[model samples]
Target: MTTDASSSFPFCPERWLSKGIWKEREIPAATTATATKKKKKTETKKTTTTTMTTGRALEAFDEGVAAAAAGDERARRRARRALVRACEEEERRIGREEERIERRRDREEAEEEAAAAAADVAVVRAREIAVANREAAVERRKEVVTEREDAVAVEMAALHQEQMAAGGEEQSRGEEE
Candidate 1:
């Protein structure tokens, strides 16, 4: 018996398959066509994704920059509004303080006027009292003078009556002698 080098290793099928060891001589036609279509579709999808990714990255970067600029503008507006509010509040406070001072000044003036009026009334009352005291003293002096005049008139009438009676007695004695 003589054996070739390939037939000596029966477990290995690489030489036997090439020589039509199986019943089917080639792979199925349908299977080959389906595999080719699947490979082409996978390659097309990868190429499209790679080409479009750059455009999408640029659009996203532009949007981020715009958003940052808008935020900065809004922050500036907020700071400006805060400063304006602070100035307005300070002006209102000063106005209120000025009004308060004006009211205090007016009150002080009113009090001073009232005090002056009261002093004037007190002076008038004191003058009236002095005048009344002078009138009362004059009345007392008039009453004393009238009483002395009445006493002197009564004494003069009594002396005249006594002198007339003494003259009548002296005439009667001369006629009897």
Candidate 2:
């Protein structure tokens, strides 16, 4: 299929030139018995036969032109078929590229969606952690306030006991006097 065009010539120009075309020799009319008898009686007469080249040359030239046209037509058909096959191959290549591109886009979109989902999950986890930390801080502040109230209550109780003891001692001393 990939052979050179010159290898497929109808007739090689160099070979045709070496072995030139020749016209067929014309045959004389068939002699009857009477014409043969007359020829035997008379002397040998030379018959003139026409060997014209113009008509035969024109015919050969016409034939050569027709053969060349046919060969040209064949060459054109081959070229057209080759072009069509190349176009079909190009179309198939483009189709494959488009399919590959589409698949890549689909994969990229899926990856992007997965990444977005992961980010959303991360944001939710961070918010949950922030809320838990705020709750823990509030609990710690409550515990500190409770401890301060307990300490204040213990101090007031100790002061009340001292005042009651002092009042009892004064009353005893006054009674003895």
Candidate 2 residue pairs that clash = none
* Candidate 1: count of backbone clashes, pairs at least 3 residues apart or interchain: 0
Once superposed on the true structure, which residue ranges of model 2 sit more than 4 Å away at CA? 1-81, 170-177
Model 1, which residues run further than 4 Å from truth? 1-72, 155-177
Candidate 1 lDDT score at position 5 = 24
Worst 10 residues of 1 by lDDT: 44-53
Each model's TM-score, in the order given? 0.46, 0.49
Q: Estimate every model's Cα lDDT from 0 to 1.
A: 0.51, 0.57
lDDT of 2 by residue, 11-91 (tens): 323332334422344434344333356545744444544333323432443443454457766544454444344434434
After superposition on all CA atoms, what RMSD does each candidate show versus the true structure? 42.5, 31.1
